[model samples]
Target chain A: MPRRTTRGQAAAAASARRPLFAATIALAMALGGQAGAQQACEVKLGALGPMSGPAAQWGLAMLGAAELAAAEANARNFTVAGRRCTVSVVSYDTRYTAEGAAAGINNLASQGVRFVIGPVGSPEVTGAKPVATRHNLLMFANSYAKNAIGPQWPLVFHLGPGPSEWAAPIVLMAQQQFGMRSVVVVAPNDQGGTDIASVDAEVYRSLGITATEEYYQRGTTNFAPIVTRILSSRPDAVDTASSPPGDSGLIVRQLRQAGFTGPIGHLGGPGTEEIIRVAGGIDVLKNFYWYEVVPTEDPQVRAIADEYKRLLGRDAPENTNMWLWVVGARMTLRAMETAGTTTDTRKVAEALRAMPVDDPNVGRGSWAGQRFFGINQELSLPFGAGLIVDGQNRGVRRIEVGQ
Target chain B: MHEFWSAAIIGVSLGAQYALLALGFTLIFGILGVINFAHGGFYALGGYVAYSAVSGLGLPYPLAVLAAVLVTAALGYVYELFVIERFVDDHLATMMLTLGLYLMISTGLLAVFGPQSPEFSFPVKGSYSIGALRIAKENLVVLAVCGCAIGAIYWLIYRTDLGRALRALADDRQVATTQGMRPRLLFPLAFGLATGLAGLTGALVTPILALSPSAGDPVLVTSFLTVILGGLGSIAGATIAALIVGFIEAYASVYLGGSAGALVLFIMVLVILLARPTGLFGRQIRGA
Candidate 1:
């Protein structure tokens, strides 16, 4: 049955339905907007290091750290500036050279990156610092140079203390075990090499060990001549101070082949595995000692490997530097989150400085580069001194900061 | 005195290896009038090929080296015939082509093997000690092999009929072609021979030292320096120049230290170039 109604009644009914339609439209729009917000506002982090050539392991570790941190941040549903954001990383290979690092900074800056995580060599950091200053970018760099972190570069931070902080303990421990009376420290003739070798030699000499520093050209492949020169001195120990892992390995192999059986002390950085691989085997490194950036044997730190594999769907880099770098990268992201801004690097830097130097995996550390680099921007964490006595790995012993 | 004799022994060993590399470098420039920037790529490829043959395929070390030589030589022959032959006369074009190939080869190696130096060691272990002088058995093996290779190269270039034709083409390409000597056929063969020598050197020396993708970068610089110091395109000049470089590098590194040793060698080369603009053995002009 059809019911007849007056025009005014029909108009009234239409008006009433309009409100419901409006309500439905509003509800749909709100849901769509929420979805858009979840996928919006990208924040990019930059990594700079030698991703190729001999020093590639260090750089790959840096990049890996950045990636793992980003993945973890995203997993936590990281937010910045009060909006849901996805953190991404862009990497540039510095080739372990000055010009390359400078150019890398410029390139990263062009892509709107305000945070950088690495430039793992002295030359690269030196090259990147000025350019980073120009661009107002915050950097977390790793280099053994004396000036790796200085007050002049307010935005720069160090991943951890270098040979300056850790070399003495390693030297003392090595001396106690190996009883090396005379040692030769071999490195490249560049600033990257000289700075560390000199510091190491000073440490050795202060301990009353006869120390001599020998510098070779950076690209010298065959270390035979240098090895010969080293052997002729009849050194009780040879320290491959700050030489790239590949170079150090070749020197060790050649030394062993030449029948120089003194314990090889690498008071530089971690590359014991690479050196062992190149030198043939652990037996080739009959007696060896090295510096590890962190107490790698620590269960908490060891868990990072399992976590990285779980989250990243692959094994972490072979270099233990990966664990140290993860702390740097995670701290950077946390600072960014605390500052509530991705573009404002100054705020992030301030936030980083104010925050406690602590990590779940690496444990706790304090900012302590004031006496050396004229700034307190260096992360001084507990590191390890590794030993191999009679071709047997004694494992890494953790040494607390300031110990 | 012990140090002096040790440096000399090292210098001789180094010279032999350098001669093998430089001879290959000069051959391409001499016959094709093309600077093969990819020469180093062949050297690195040879090392990787040998490494894979031994490590991946379970071949014996000697067979692996031979496989490396054959594979590199064949690749070089194909590359020359197909790509490089078109622009062989255009030096700039050939330079660009070779440089591009070098990049490709290096990048490919990096992708396949990664950046780290693989665990590759010489089959012969230990060293021979004569009094206070010590030499790695591997180094002596390399030196002996290099000496034999150098002698064979001389015989091939100076005595063989194919060598005569190749030299005729180098002397005057247009005339040699008019006289029925075919560059299209012989040029590829020459390039193959050069690249094969480079591969042989890499297969021999890399195991003794280290085998990484970037290992070729230093090899290229050394080869270029040796070739330029001797005389580009002059086989004898390259040989003499390599020995001089090796001796200087050894003596200077030993006496003056590694840093100053490299500087001294460069300064000596600079002085030589200043005195003789054409190099120690270079001619005024190439007939080609």
Candidate 2:
């Protein structure tokens, strides 16, 4: 009887082992299938930006836009040269410094990323361009510095509007709409601020408007003294040229509180919503004007912006810089399709220059920068004039700026 | 003349906020002989707490300020009990510990609140203008609140038994022990009070300035300069220094460019330090 009981236990153990062996085989087959899929035509895109510092919001927005583009491409099974390819963006934080940019670029290069987006600010581009050129990597940078573009940085592509281009139309609009004959231009005492202030001053001069420039340190919170000085000029408008969203919002609020009833104009894109939100309500946003590439009135553009908001759970792209990145990513992917290869930087760069960008979000764009940077590497999109009415950023009409 | 009046009002408003921050720093350093770098973090935390109270829970601004002070003071007590108590006499260790605390709190704030700057509006709106000079009602309210707070702090420090015990402890801990004063109890209470002051200042200033996780950094730097310039443990000196610094910043930014203004102020502080190592009003310490 004891022998029969032992036989039954052995039989049960044998049945368990058979099922386990079968399950192991199934798991191996599944993993093998995944590995094969991963090995088939993958493109690694690197995004370098200040992901951790005060400028972290810009980086986060850029990454979010890129990831959104990548997900859309993958969902559509985006293919290049008859090969099904998956685009993946690996982000490196530059900490908003030149040294940080260099390290980030080197790290991304080591990871074999041939196509890069950002190293957002001009200073970062200056720091990372050498490393990028050495790696033969194609970089689409969100910079306005003319020095960052042209023949000096062959592998670099400027993504946004140049300072002159961005400020010219807004100054014109301010003059035309509000009869702004004179303006007070306030900017942070930083590279971007200096650049924008100079450009706005030039643009205002060209448009026959007197521009009084005032600057505050990067982290200056108390703007009463500065506002008083600005109001002392008694300008027709207050031009917050290219300040960060937070700083610009503070300046606007303070300017209003200081009893300046003139029109307030801001240069740049998408952050208008943030400015509106920060300034308390749309009433504060009255008489405020900004410029952007995105045509918010277009149903397709609105759909894309809404989708981005839904995907990221953030305010619709209020940053034109981020919108530029989205356009750059899409354009890069399109160039890859045109060139039939993602690894050949020269072919992709040439394709990008030759291609005309007419997308739902950015409208009609062309290769500009010939007159300014001596190279047609900057994507010049038709800009839209935006007005804040009842706390909403509504697109007024498309305007010809640089191109 | 309008610009000057505006600059003066702005300077005084900013000076009041700096005074509160410096007062807390001086008090903590007076009793503990250690610079509490985490004071700025406590300040930022107070702003966030008040923001959440008003924005999320729909509390009145006054109640939010009260809630922030209480919450932050309790956290300060807990922090002292758990972390600060371990290195009481070792100044270097305490500095490192507080710095770590600062980093942790700032990072935690960023993680929770995100990097976006949040604006807090005072319930009061608009400004009162007096012949080309406009003063925001909120700014006036902030000044009034700060004045009341400073008065309360003065009364607490000079009038109460707790104040006497704290003074005794600051003067000589050994003697205080003989006089039946408990160092452990008094130390935590003092720390809490100092942090509460920081929290109150944060709450008052939030309506004026947008709140960000790193917003405390500039305030922290200014507070350090204030304490050093005024005398490390001198409350009265800190108040005066804060006003000087505030007025200098306002005028300098307007006359010189913003960066140049900051440079000028720092240079002045450097010259002052060179002239008087003990600071403008600081008493000399014995044995180092």
Candidate 3:
């Protein structure tokens, strides 16, 4: 039979175990420090993107691309400044908001990371650019904002050309395929939406097609009222411009349910797969056209998925933007390797700007943002235009962007 | 005229859903004197639980919804009884606890389900057309179910003995305890009932729209706004306010475009709050 413990005895017993708890904590910290000190060279790359919202697919793609590139570089023994270094990625979920991205940049900076490979929306880029510049961190950002990569932000590089470069051709192709005379572009009223929708609408107007821009508040779950408003306009087609895939899918489904049978276009980023999934299926999607970041049907381009799986031990993110982001991340890593220093962001930026825009998977591309953002730091890779006619998949067709 | 009718249909459907959500939100605050910040987590959890029951366990849709309500209600009951009970009197403490719970629930869902909207859809597809005005059959089902749930909640709170005890406790805890009412026993029941309503709403509505881990983020904001406008502790106010909010959102979004419409809704709420600090049907705040 154990004796009943008094309060005094309990206090004495707790005091006796305090040293052991402190010692355990000290030992863990010491081991962590020792592991860090033992590493000869480690390059920390920040991967910032929305990881938990409707735009999560794009952000997850960004993270996947960064991880894949880092893994690939490790396999080849990525060397910087004559020292073999292992690349590690630090990711922060920006939640597709400006403040989230800005804070993420500061967080990465606090962790001694000098480069970043994400923040994949207009508002995020807008928020992150100032913080990234203030922290001297070079960012490879992807945004369709008109001022995505301007002269003001020299260290910020665009992941790919926005609607400024690709929208016209896609609009032309869509027009040819669907023969639509008028279209309504629906998107969130935020910077992320307005910038891209306005550009896409301008392209439609340029092509002699009537385009109406209907902006909605972000975080709107149901689009029925908006759909009713859209139907009131009675447009020939509806283009979901930069609305997160979830929102776009709901809009598409609602439109169809409301008896709008015309072709639907996603002139924003690459999220057709997510849209199709969320909108039920291809049958529910009916006639659809969208921008594909790369010619997904091309074996050379499709090989990236196989490589990602081989290297990362997991299937690649389904969003096609992952392929594009892989190019961006791999290029950033290669630039650091070329410049021979991960800490010197300026040298890395210079190296990246000077490096020829070429990828084994995406083929050769040109840097062409001077006409749009007044900076020639945009990666204008060849992309694809995908289509679905009457619920039939009409595979993506490759389209080249000349500098 | 067609657009008017379409917006009205959407408004009524949205009103029913909002009323269900706000009633739950106001219930926890009213009786328990604790703002359940994890209300949205329960909503999202409800959606995921139903999704799992149907998709993982191969249960029928109706059964899945029932499972969602039971699971969420039980979880809420346990959480309130054990964790929240300790800090029920401390507003700040309860707020922190509920908020932390929300974070855990959302993060857990994200980890388990991943950041993609699963292919869960309303079983009934297509819409019923009345000339130019079209309403999704799924929305109609949700509206009807929400109406019944609201009615059931009213009956439970007004016509039942449990309601009288709960209301008695809400009016004067010290007196109610002296009069043979056990707060510890009734509080959990009230909490479970409220969360079950949220769960029911989530199960019925998410499939019609979309279901994701973060779906509850907006739900929480909208519910908070609606409850505040309705006078925080008034059931009648919450019901009327939800419909007002729904109609305002639909009509404004339809007539004034989406962006302006949302702005207008917030401004109107602000104006109403300024005009009546206690809300349209609110009583004076009781001193503990």
Q: Give me the candidate number with maximum lDDT.
A: 1
Model 1 lDDT per residue over A1-403, tens place: 9999999999999899999999999988988887877655677889999988778888988999999999999999988878778999999988899999999999999998999999899999999999999999999999999889898999999988878678888889999998999999999898889989999999999889999999999888888989988998899999998888888889999998878999998877678888899889999989999999999999999998888899999999888898999999999999988999888999999999999988999999998899988998999899999999999999999999778
Please report, as a residue range, the 10-residue window in candidate 1 chain A with the lowest summed lDDT: A34-43
Better of 1 and 2 by TM-score: 1
RMSD of 3: 9.9
> In model 3, where do residues sit more than 4 Å from their true spots?
A1-40
Task: Write candidate 3's Cα lDDT for A238-269 as tens digits.
Answer: 99989999899989888988889999999998
Model 2, B147-234: lDDT tens digits are 8988888888889999888878777778878999887897888888889888898888866777878777877898999999999987
Q: Give every collision pair in model 1.
A: none
Looking at candidate 1 chain B, the ten consecutive residues that score lowest on lDDT are B126-135
Best by TM-score: 1
By DockQ, highest first, what's the ranking?
Answer: 1, 3, 2
Return the interface RMSD of the candidates, in order shown, one decimal each.
0.9, 2.0, 0.7
What would the TM-score be for candidate 1 when compared with the true structure? 0.95
